[model samples]
Target: MRGFGDLEAEIMDRLWSWGRAATAREIVDDLQLRRPLAYTTVTTVADILHTKGWLRREKVGRAWVYEPTCTREAYTAQLMHQALETTSDRAGALLHFVDRMSGDEASALRAALEQVKERDTP
Candidate 1:
């Protein structure tokens, strides 16, 4: 239910954006373009992410390749849900959230709600 740390977020962002499994070395290399990072540091954080169930990994040759267990969108939803849970008035919080949405985002939310409503109708 908790969010990722700085390096953890960096690693997850790379894997999600890449849309494929990647070894820690590949992540480290990509991160190096933005800032210096050690391979071992990335590997250790990746292992932590795996343990935390945010990532799935498999041994490929001598390295462990990692991929996200959920999409970035799913993660965003979970964080939003968690934020709502922290408020005493969920409805009020949601109203505030809706009020801040742009026109396109509001339209998408309405469309998604309609789909859910149609699916739930019995």
Candidate 2:
């Protein structure tokens, strides 16, 4: 899928951070604290997100409640995969990334790898 526009990204951020289905009014209210935005603007963006398949909404009390179709982590993983695809030497790039990880992150990666190995052992 294509990346989001600035306003669209902000709208998604609000949905992911809110961690619940929310009406356009709620998103607009949250965003308004940073700057002014009209309710229709938010509503339009939410509808656009729904059309893009990034959000799904249901009608509730004459208003549409929107929520992300994918979790932030899932989106993040897709972006990371996309980044890796740009490199000619994927393995070398991944290795370099691993080499730069903090100690705790490295430990977690090692533990995750071990779990995968165990699962594959039958």
Per TM-score, the best of the predicted structures is 1
Regions of model 1 farther than 4 Å from truth: none
TM-score, each model? 0.96, 0.86
Residue-level lDDT of model 1, residues 10-117, one tens digit each, is 999999899999988899999999998878888889999999999999998999989999999999999999999998999999999999999999999999999999
Q: Across residues 36-122, which tens digit of lDDT does each residue of candidate 2 receive? A: 999998899899999999999999999999999999989987888988999999999999999999999999989989999999998
The C-alpha RMSD in Å for every predicted model, in order, reads 0.8, 1.8
Judged by whole-model lDDT over C-alpha atoms, candidate 1 comes out at: 0.94
Q: What is the C-alpha lDDT of each candidate?
A: 0.94, 0.93
Q: How far is candidate 2 from the true structure (C-alpha RMSD, Å)?
A: 1.8
- Number of the top-ranking candidate, with lDDT as the measure: 1
Q: Which stretches of candidate 2 lie over 4 Å from their true place?
A: none
